[model samples]
Target: MYENSTELAENKLLLLHIIKSVTIPISNTQLTDIVLENSFVNYFTLQQYITELINTDFLKYVEVNKKKSLQLTQKGENVLMLFKDRISPSKLNQIDEYIHTKIESLKKEFSITADYLPANKDSFIVNLKAIENDTLLLDLKVNVVSKKQAVDLCTKWKHNSADIYNKILNALINE
Candidate 1:
């Protein structure tokens, strides 16, 4: 039983460490995939640990680019630094390696954002952004009279952001 508890503690630390080591905030899905791939913890238990960390103010869940993402708080970083030795050096290296491999794809995942809000009773305002390495390449807002148009714009933005960017740039340069 003592060993099990120790393992749980290590898992929590591991989770925090992984979050800190990454360049961008991670979604729950990304966290789950990495944890399950590297650790012995199951999905439900992993979620429980995440909740406990959030409740304790060690981790904060926030919407980044309109998607739920996990970020390590300063308290979490300090705690990890204090107990990080309990996790082996080799394990740390493995975590770093895994994140390094996935870094580019993860950046791409969060590089675009789309959201809508009610502007008034009759219209909705859609916000769209395209980002690269923390730089905002495009920020657009459109007002439409119907929610369906707002939704469709968001969907199309997600699918064709690159093409849209090129066309806009080409128009500006040619004009």
Candidate 2:
């Protein structure tokens, strides 16, 4: 159990309010960036608050697109509704403004995903995707004979997914 200090409680509630406002599961990295960019809390303290929220069932982890992300539980929503006034109005407005400014780009960033899995003793399968607004722009599965090759493909796709996507589209569309 952690200390019930006022700052701690407010920060925890702030996090819950942000997650609830998003109305969708969000990656920890995105959440951290939003909170820390605004100087809402330090990284260590933010992490601690998250852990406490999860432990208390105020938040939970869920997998979206095979990515682990944080979500507000119903209990979290209820709690925030009950005591969200603890968050200063200025801080609340800042969070909302920052999220609005960045949510679409953040979603687009997370939508491009790459991963690999073993297909058999000697081969690996790489899955690459570029998605936007819940639409699949590109989805490619490549089979390679070695793990290194699969890893390279995944890495390259992540680094140059837009370029690769454009090239593919051009190749298919042009004579």
Candidate 3:
């Protein structure tokens, strides 16, 4: 069994709470209300945390009624399952399959070769190659991205795209 640090555990718990309280396509106003009602976390912190979550792909924006609202991704759902003690080997396998299929589709789309291999019991590595141009390595600890889109990103941003790629790569590594 993996044991998490106190701070990490607490932050995960807080994220779970936020995910649960908000509806699909939740507005900032609704998220603020949830933060105000459920936890002692301040509004600014809650907003900051939500933005971070979105950047990390745990949360995504949904367009509803011409408004952008937040919804949890599969990654967020998995995190919540972890918090609820409902994460099992079978569940993990299902998630893995889903992620793999997504990656395959992306690879086909971007004309890139990708290898999604288990790094450890808890994480996976997605190493991508762009047909001798550049290698874009994404170390995904918890979330998944499309391989083809990743390669396309590399192709589109190959020249003078290091800064943006570096920022994204840094975020993935830090997470």
Model 1 worst lDDT run, 10 consecutive residues: 1-10
Q: Which regions in candidate 2 have their CA more than 4 angstroms from the true location?
A: 1-4, 118-124, 144-152
The best candidate by lDDT is 2
Residue 162, candidate 2: how far off, in angstroms? 3.7
After superposition on all C-alphas, the RMSD of every candidate to the true structure, in Å, is 3.2, 2.8, 19.2
Those runs of model 1 whose alpha carbons end farther than 4 Å from true positions after fitting are 1-3, 63-67, 116-126, 142-156
lDDT of 3 by residue, 1-175 (tens): 2244554445544555454543334566655654475443577767776888888887788874345667788887777766744333453444345434444332333333334555555545554433312243432222235555444544454433335446776887896
**Model 1, 29-121: lDDT tens per residue?**
989988888874789988998999999999999987668899999999999989999887888898999999988767766887788999999
* Lowest-sum lDDT 10-residue window in model 2: 1-10
Reference-based lDDT, residue 144, model 1: 98
Q: Each candidate: what lDDT? A: 0.87, 0.88, 0.52
TM of each candidate vs. truth: 0.76, 0.80, 0.40
For candidate 1, list the clashing residue pairs, or say none: none
Error of 1 at 6 (Å): 1.6
Please give the range of 10 consecutive residues that has the lowest summed lDDT in model 3: 132-141
Better of 1 and 3 by TM-score: 1
lDDT per residue as tens, model 2, 132-170: 777889988989999999999988997888899999999
